[model samples]
Target chain A: MRDIVCEILSNKEVGENIFEMVLLADRVDDIQGGQFVNIQLPNKEMLLRRPFCLCDFDEVNKTFTICYAVVGEGTKVLSGLAVGQQLKATLPLGNGFLLSGKYNKIMLIGGGMGSAVLPAIARRNKDVECVCYLGFANKGKVVLEEKLREVCSKVVVATDDGSYGESGFVTNIAKADLDSLGVDAIFCCGPEVMYRAIKKTFADVNIPIFVSLEQRMGCGIGACLVCNCKIEREGKQGYYRVCKDGPVFELKEVVL
Target chain B: MQRRTSIRVERGGIVSNLKVNIAGVEFKNPIITASGTFGFGREFNNFYPLSDLGGICTKGLTLMPRDGNPAPRIAETKSGIINSVGLQNPGIEHYLATDDKWLAEQDTVVIANIAGASLDDYIAMGEKINESNAQMVELNISCPNVKAGGMAFGVLPASVEQVTRAVKNVCKKPVITKLSPNVSCIADNAKAAQNGGADGISLINTLSAMAVNYKTRKPILFNNNGGLSGACVKPVALKMVWDCYNAVDIPIIGLGGITSYTDVLEFMICGARAVQVGTYNFTEPMGASQIAKDLENYVKEQDMDINDLVGSLILNK
Candidate 1:
């Protein structure tokens, strides 16, 4: 595959350690939500793929956006990327979130940069009545609040430090909202801690829960073993490649 | 500009079928992405079409799930990286449930790399793999940082024999035991795997290495330790592959920082039946396919037959 350099539409800090990068890629087609784009870092020495959920897509504008955190050298370059700068990229990779029309009341939950993928999921199932719960460390780390509000029927923000919105884990807020509003399905993406917390609290929720996993990937494709996630079903257990099967998985299907 | 000379000058000629049949298994090409390098086959496919390459060796999976080591699990030194990912997989069960369908659809071969913290862990996971559609199972006994099993089992010949035997009991699939480089005798370890009934062997997983941060005066990786790989380790890996080649009769899959067809030829000349592409994947996104194409041209130019060069490298008397 030939690597093409696309112009950066904008790169700005949206929240704490979180950045939003808009790129002008006319060749991008059939891009999906869970699919990610790989960007070359400012430093060529660190040559590993940084996987980011496709945040939003624009066919008319021929632009796509990705939300990421400043976790490593790749993100450092991604954060510093300037408008109009050309970036080498491979776009719209991996199986995206599965969309089904069977469900109606939807709950979109995100913690930290996990919230990056929420809007795309919401956009995918716009016909459903959607509610969103977003968690962050504090107000400084909060992002996309207004944008999420535009898509969902209701939006709730939770911060651990109590700098903004409710002061507690977002899962707690989600539980309260779900009890009152009653959702048919729950979709979430966030850190391992938050995912675990949500998984445990929602154990009795009785809804089809979906979680987006975060793993360090090498090829961004299934060639490397670094991002293998284990799964067990019907008395059988085996390894699943996160880069392929999911960055988004049904909560019951995932081990953690 | 004049084209550079090709890497294959041997009897095998350029690998037209780049696709090869090893131990009754089929691979699209001889070039395979090593374990821990190409996550599951999906990540890289987003960059390049996987049909271009031969196979993929997934990251090491264990019996029970693991969170892996603390932060700073990776560090870069010169042309290589030292990583202590600590076998951070979601256990064997999680992998099969989620990714089985996607894997069965791929054109390339899929080999599952199994790691363990104990003998039971190895056997239990091996049993699970034997039931799946995985073409082969790579026993990763070479990781250095972990305390319970990893490098400890890899270094001692007796432990290697014991673990290999344990895994062999349940795993009916072709078992490829990945040997560690930090051991005193690479040949001895190769012999150990052969004695334990391993169908094949993979030489030189990763060398235990460390790097220091100048500013903080601490280790570069958060784990304070990691495995070294890349261009620098190819020579060492090739030498070990040659030594192991002479020591064992079974096939050997060679890996460690192979970015070019020349490196593939060196490993083949030294006695590797097949080769795995490692760190180069991080640098060149489509390195495996590029090497596959480059080697094909090299094979065509060499005009040598395949059998003549397959494990046919001669040593000075």
Candidate 2:
């Protein structure tokens, strides 16, 4: 990965607490859908860099977008970053989600802000048919629904209080459609609680579930062993560097 | 912004003296990546060449492979970070079998940072290191995460001497005892290492600290506590290095929160022959190498020998 100074093209809130930040910088020659970029906040009070998944990228304009929520001190600083400001960024980090085949239909599931990782999947595999399932707390919390619709073949948005597209959980709808959809693969990004729900709901279904993990990270490049994820690769069960070894893994392999 | 690739590259009748001799090992420069911060150098080599660094200390290696502590091992605070990774490493045998050959070819000095459960483990690993390609051995007896050895030996002066003498007796390469900052008397420990025949000494390791979550009223780190490092610790490190400089005759390799060329210079003026860049590497992908570059520029611009800066600080009486 290369470190370069990126100029903020735009920074605006897209959802209740979520924001979409666009940057103008050198063209990222190699960007996989699930890969991420680590942006350093220009403040001295916050020393660690903030990592974001690639929400959208334009190769021609050498621009990339990161969709973030003001969750902590760092992101609050990121949200306040004005247009035309410069920030140091290291791009195209982590092993992106490995699609099984080039030509295969896939099911993508996102929970709340996890929807930010969905559009990239469909963006990369344009040839493959992508049906998406998104779950949000309510209409106010929903994000990236339209962005997913622009890339995927179908988009099903669900809210807990029935304030949006459909009522109940999105997983239930995806589970019902799984039998007939005959999708070749499934990819998910969400909280551990949601992963538990998916694991219990899809245990009988035999499709390989791919997941992107989120962890507090350091070095973004994997030297510092702070961001560790447990997974059983081969027969050995061990902790892997989430920054280097993953951020993406086979659902069954992820110990958590 | 241009990088001077060699140690003594002369231009306009100016000889860039970025070279440093620590414990009889000649480093092309004074920039070494701190152990446990920079892994085997494979991941970072993708950004820059390994030869750009003057030295590398491998992740702390134990006799047997360790799974390390549970997740939430790190928490970032203001201007620094606290971590309790517990030295999760591939074991010394794995390194010698797999990573040793590759590290040897990196065209820079490799200092093996080894920790252990007991004195026997330290001596055994030291003896075993002779069979590898490492240029020096850095005894990591200051890790705060583990329960048995590490920090236990680093706190008191007598045990520090014993551990150093034990490793020095068996290890063929020069032995540098890495000191912990959490001790009550850092200079005494430096003198202890010197008394035990240590080739050199490096200080200070991360200080013991914690980060708490007020909402849950619990600790942020899974280990409850960890060692803190970053720019915040530089002042503490400089003072400790100066204290140790007055206490011992052995070469000093200073560390703790080193981020820039001036920080490197401060360590040298306080009597460090060389310095290691730690938490800053996590800040900048090319941090350690970049610091070496910035230092080279300053050295060339001044046309001065870097050695003259060692212990050059003047105090008001």
Candidate 3:
């Protein structure tokens, strides 16, 4: 990964503390879904590097986008980056979702900020019909609903509070759709509860379901065993690294 | 502000070799970026070639996938940091199937750090890593801030012994058990690991700590508590290393808030054959390699052999 001094082409507020920023990168080759770039925030006072999952990538335009919620000082600084200001990043790191000849139909489920990985997954697998199930707290906190609708065959939105699309969690609506559409596979990136709920819903379904696990990654790459999660297969269980082994895995494989 | 010199200093018409050997296995150098700090050596390669380092201890891998804890997981304190990431990860099979190819190609010792909630969990995960190109298994028995069988197994010397014995039973390669600093007696724990037939031991994982946001009247981290790291915890970690050094004869890999060559020297003097850079990598991108260079220079400047510095400062009580 090359550290390029990127100029913020545009910064748009997507939700609370969440901003979508388009960066002009000279080095944008091999960028894909589930892959993330490490950004070096301004003012060296903030020591650690902040990582944001790639929301979308455009090679012809020499630009890629990142949608992140400013949860800390590092992100707050990134959100304040002006259109002309220079930002540094270690681009195209971590193994992304494998889209190679596996399934015909895929259900992309995202919750809150995890919706960041959806657009890229949809665009790359245009041949496969993508059904999206997005969960939000309320209508006011929703993001990328319209954009997702354009790419996916069917876009299902669910809010905890009955202020939008479906009045329950995205998994409930997804379970209802499974009888008719019967998704061949599932791709998810969201809160733990949402994923856990989805895991139970698809417990009996003999289909491949992948989910992206999140952690406070010290290094966006894998070196530290800091991000460890428990797993079980055929009566045996152990730990897995979210950064290296995943951030993507089949849901059935998860013990959660 | 002046930029720090990242250029490699030359010596004797040769690029200095920083390779390290532990229990017959050769690491390119003694400088291994610790688990949870470097990721899989892939991301660091984006900024700098990962092959330059001696080795990498991958983030902990389990049998099944886990979503980990909620957000607000990390909280930076005065001189250290506290985190409750809750070991978020995809399952081990996924890693072996997907990331193994990329991991094998790297010219570094890929040490798979394995963690589990139970004995069965440890054995299963160790078996998976044994099937891969992973050079060794760094059994992570020191994750102090997590619930659900993680920190509990690490805190007790008996459990440490059991887990080490269990993992060593399944793993084909060397098993280095990473110990928790949160324990009351780290030496006893180290002895427990040694008795359990651990090939080597890595010290001072993380100290249990926390920080509260006064304005919000809540803990800064989402988990309400976290493991502290960075320069601030160096002394505590050093103490643990010193204690473990005196208690056990096994090779010690010292860690916790190592930021400079001075800190590395301190650990070496305390009987660490090698050092793992943890939170320091987050502070400086090339902190580990830079420290390695500094150690080499310091050795040459002091007109001393590299081995001479090992255990040179024991207080013979």
**Cα-based lDDT at residue B137, candidate 2:** 95
TM-score for each prediction?
0.67, 0.96, 0.61
| DockQ of each model vs. true complex | 0.20, 0.73, 0.20
Q: What is the DockQ (computed on Cα atoms) for candidate 1? A: 0.20
Summarize candidate 3's per-residue lDDT along B10-92 as a digit string, tens digits: 32232333345676788655678888777666656756667766788887778888667756667766667787777766678
Query: Candidate 1, which segments miss by more than 4 Å at Cα?
Result: A1-7, A26-29, A38-42, A84-95, A153-182, A192-206, A222-225, A228-241, A250-256, B1-179, B187-202, B209-228, B238-253, B265-274, B279-285, B297-317
Model 1 alpha-carbon miss at residue A39, Å: 3.9
Clash count list over all predictions: 47, 0, 36
> Tens digit of lDDT per residue, candidate 3, span A109-160?
8898899899888876778888998988888788988878878999988898
Estimate every model's Cα lDDT from 0 to 1.
0.78, 0.89, 0.77
- Segments in model 2 whose C-alpha atoms lie over 4 Å from true places: A100-103, B1-14, B143-151
Relative to the true structure, candidate 2 reaches a TM of 0.96
Q: For each model in turn, which proportion of the native inter-chain contacts is also found?
A: 0.34, 0.71, 0.37
Instruction: Please state the error at residue B216 of candidate 3 in Å.
Output: 11
Query: Candidate 1 docking: what grade?
Result: incorrect
* Alpha carbon lDDT at B235, candidate 3: 88
TM-score of chain A of each: 0.93, 0.96, 0.92
lDDT of candidate 1 over B1-317, digit per residue (tens): 22112344344334434456667888766888888777676656766777777788877887778767654556667667787777777778877887655766778778899987777778898899976677888899864424453447888888888888899999988888999999999999999999998989997888989999777899977678778988889989988998998899888899987879988888888888789998888766777888988888877776543334556677789
